[model samples]
Target: MANAHMRKKEPDKVRRSLLDRTAKLAVDQGPAAITIQAVATAAGVTKGGLLHHFANKQALLEAVFADLLKQLTDEIDRYMAEDPQPFGRFTRAYVRAAFADHKLGVRSPWAALSVTMVADPGMRRLWSDWLDGHLAAHRATDDTPLLEIVRLAADGVWMADLMGQDRAEPRDMTGLEPQLLALASRPPSA
Candidate 1:
């Protein structure tokens, strides 16, 4: 009976292992490099074992995408919890989280999974749905232009760093956070 209980937990472990391996491959070699056999080999599991957890490559990539969104959402939530101001909390938290991820050498799953999204329409729809839901949940009350600008700038900074375009000796992307936050704090102009 104890063994049976333990067996139930094993699948989740195996699933996580497979997803981690797939994410690594997607980061290191691009999503094109992710295949059932390749992921299984990278994860030290047989192809059958990987398939048991993920019905196919699409399923595996979907899981990876979902996990990535969850991590980002959780990080943003943590930042929001620390921020007192309600007006700019979402954009501020987003910028801070992106910088934190870069400092920690964490690769965004969206970069890694882009190929899968391009290859599979279903994956794109899944991602779109997730983003739509996230935006709906975190919708800003004021909807100021500065908030949009700050978010766009943050995305540009993140993309530049992700693509190795930010050639500064010390990455100080966070330096812009205060300025953006200031803009976010102001009331919309008449």
Candidate 2:
């Protein structure tokens, strides 16, 4: 019984260690640097061990995206539950959180994963489906047109932010939050 318990705990420890190493490597260098051997070395495991958990680079990339989405969703869900904000408020928070990095010229790991997905048609399809669902959900809300505009604007902001086109000094959007909230409260389009 004691041996079995230790054995069970060992895999969990290894799995977490692998994930931590992968995240650190991803943060330090980009997804392209996340080879199985590199992850194993960073995690102090053998390549065989890494492969045991993740069959290949594709699987590893998928896991990374899944983890990232779960984290973002959890934070947004918590905020929505606490405040129940208008659409603009929600958009502001989403943009601020998603593109709030202080460092300019740094390539986003999220974008790196997105590039990886582009190479895989299945993942591309999955993302398209997910976006469609999200858009549908937004359209179903009370302030449809205003929220839609806010959503579209927010996407442009994110694209610029992600693509490094927004080279201007990062302005504090602190005051704009309230304004966005007011705009979001507008009635849906007829």
Can you tell me which runs of candidate 1 are displaced by over 4 Å? 1-9, 105-111, 114-120, 140-142, 165-174
List clash counts for every candidate, in order.
Answer: 0, 0
Q: Candidate 2 lDDT (Cα, whole model)? A: 0.61
Stretches > 4 Å off in candidate 2: 1-9, 85-93, 99-108, 117-122, 133-139, 165-181
TM-score for all models, in order of appearance: 0.78, 0.71
Q: What's the lDDT of the predicted structure labeled candidate 1? A: 0.75
lDDT of 2 by residue, 1-190 (tens): 2243344447677877877677667767867798998998887767777788889877776666666666666655555566555544455445444544323225445555655666777667666675566556554453356665665665555555555535576545455445555666665555
TM-score attained by model 1: 0.78
**Residue pairs of candidate 2 with colliding backbone atoms:** none
**lDDT to native, each model:** 0.75, 0.61
Model 1 C-alpha lDDT per residue in residues 25-117, reported as the tens digit of each score: 988887878889999999877787788898998888888888887888898889889988787777778778767766654365666675567
lDDT at position 149, candidate 1: 85
Winner by lDDT = 1
Lowest lDDT sum, 10 consecutive residues, model 2, at 96-105
